[model samples]
Target chain A: MQPYNYPSKYLENAVEEFAKLPGIGRRTALRLVLHLLNKPKEEVEQFSATLNEMVQNIHFCSICHNISDNDICSICSSTSRDKTTICVVETIKDVMSIENTMQYKGLYHVLGGVINPMEGVGPADLNIESLVNRLKSNDINEVIMALSATTEGDTTNFYIYKKIKDYNIVVTTLARGVAFGNELEYTDEITLGRALLNRVKFNNSFSVE
Target chain B: MQPYNYPSKYLENAVEEFAKLPGIGRRTALRLVLHLLNKPKEEVEQFSATLNEMVQNIHFCSICHNISDNDICSICSSTSRDKTTICVVETIKDVMSIENTMQYKGLYHVLGGVINPMEGVGPADLNIESLVNRLKSNDINEVIMALSATTEGDTTNFYIYKKIKDYNIVVTTLARGVAFGNELEYTDEITLGRALLNRVKFNNSFSVE
Candidate 1:
């Protein structure tokens, strides 16, 4: 595509800034900027104000390091949540992904990132120390490593496991198997093998046998 | 999809604002907000500031109705451009698309939008009067209707043609034809028929004979 030559410097600058976002290209950025331009003046101002306010006022949970309005997150302060189990994750996004499942009622401990030597992210760089302090101070009965299925995730999980191995608690990881609704034909060999290795007993609940 | 429940209200508000943009869903909005959260405070501040500044300060070209930094646009003010010819388009985005083509060296007239009765848009609502005033005051030789191929585009084209029929200037439109690089098998009947009816003289540039 030809180099963009927007009519206004402000439009060009705005497009440039929006283009810096992940997965957004110049064309899409221009489209978005034009959409903003068409919006009412107050609405655009409100949009801008919302972002600034969020960035300035947002807080990280003091206990779990998740994004929060207050020092402690809602889940951490809620008495109804399972206080004995803490799910150790790579980032705040993982916590949200798990929460969306509506399955787990336990608390979360965001590591901020995984241990990746290539990226120069070490165990010390993450919120691992804060997690250790939480474990030491609390009567937590279970610690679940809910990181991704990547090498960095595995390394981070192992390091955290070592740090909390002395504790009189059950340490577990997410079950590795064929995902629900996933066809075996499309499953990779390693995942298929793992699914077979950790196969669960067949319980035909739908059958009237 | 599960209902989103971000840890922070600020995060939720920011995501909501971003989700209002075209094609951005709640999930994508959340991802973008989280990405913003990860950026440096100064960078995010700059992003917010840039948007506000653009919305507050951006100008529209008085001559062509395109988005402009100053009173007149570059194309309209440039000395080398063909001032005798004007390509009328539907929006500022259309002007940018023509500019990107690097084809037509003529000036432009942005209608802001085409006539769409179904959407309550009419000639009176657009910059048609301004265009007529420009024609009456200036010595323009030709006017090209470069609007879309939709029914609204055709209606606006005929309306404009009728408005300028009494004027001494020649009026034209973008030729309706089968587009270049389109496969014959997939070409729609009307377009293919139009292409056949308006077939150009054969040129032998590629043949050895």
Candidate 2:
């Protein structure tokens, strides 16, 4: 590993900060930092100021735990949204993803994260208690678990199910089957098997009218 | 072109700012901004603060135009560096790339960018005047044009050559060759032809002792 010969301390510090991001490596970080140097001084200042403003002023929705500008998120407060159905998701990104489909209109309950024992995350660390409280007092008819297909996701879903099973509300999980655009021959055996066993009528399968 | 339903204005603004950077798309920008929300608040503050510090305080070397902490960069002020030679490059990143090679110890003259008529960047937009002034005042013995292998690079090199052709100094360009570790079968015609025409002595080809 040959050492970098950065010409200035300020440039080096900026690169190190960018490299701390999730997928940005040192070289990409250096490239991004240098790009900022070429931008207008006011633009760069605005970039930093905006980041600071986000970290300082951003809030988490009290009802759903989604990142928000106020105590309640836009989805949670909207009058037109389906208040009877609640979708349990892992993060705010998932909420946006579901919203992009223009399919689901129900309000969301963000769990912050799933149960991953290896990472020391458990039900207590999530928003499970608040979720249970919401179900206890609200007229919610169904709770849909929209987690990933990983083992951790299953474990989290099972744990949440146990906590809310006694309630009169219906509990369901996202459909597991062959995905659209994926060839049937290339689909994993488990997914293909599930798709076959839970096949919907041909007319109901397609999204086109 | 579906509209994004970002829950918070701050998050949306941050994503827009991150997307403005080179190579970063809107989806990647959202992921990165969410990643920052997970990091400790102090860490996020430090990240923004470092960026602000860089844009406000970083300087360009008065002698070489390279980025520096002071008016005179460390390379220009060093006693052990070879002051009789100058490597003319296009940007600070190029300066670091050459420095990382551990081969060249000469000072650099950053041209900011190559001559590109399409972008309206001309010779006057670069640091050619400062380089000329340095050549006039110093006892330089060689000038290396280490620009890219493009029409713009060649135009810049030829333009610089014309400016200092009468000086008592050697003007050289980097040898064009097939990149190390690249298969010759896949090398492009122009590069392969250049490699053959400009083949180096076998004894001086590699870095191994």
Model 1 TM-score, 2 decimals: 0.94
Candidate number of the best DockQ: 2
lDDT of 1 at B121: 98
- Give one digit per residue, the lDDT tens place, for model 2 in B1-209: 57788989999999999999999999999999999999899998999899999999999999999999999999999999999999999999999999998888898999999999999999999999999999999999999999999999999999999999998889999889898789999999999999999888888886445
Over 4 Å off in model 1, which ranges? A203-209, B203-209
Candidate 1 per-residue lDDT, tens place, A77-168, comes to 99999999999988888998899888899999999889999999998899999998999999999999999999899998889899989988
Best-fitting candidate, measured by TM-score? 2
Question: Model 2: runs farther than 4 Å from truth?
Answer: A207-209, B206-209
Please give, for residues B70-175, the per-residue lDDT of candidate 1 as tens digits. Answer: 7888888999999999999999988888888787899999998999999999889999999999999999999999999989999999999988989999999887
**Clash total of candidate 2:** 0
Give every candidate's TM-score on chain A. 0.94, 0.96
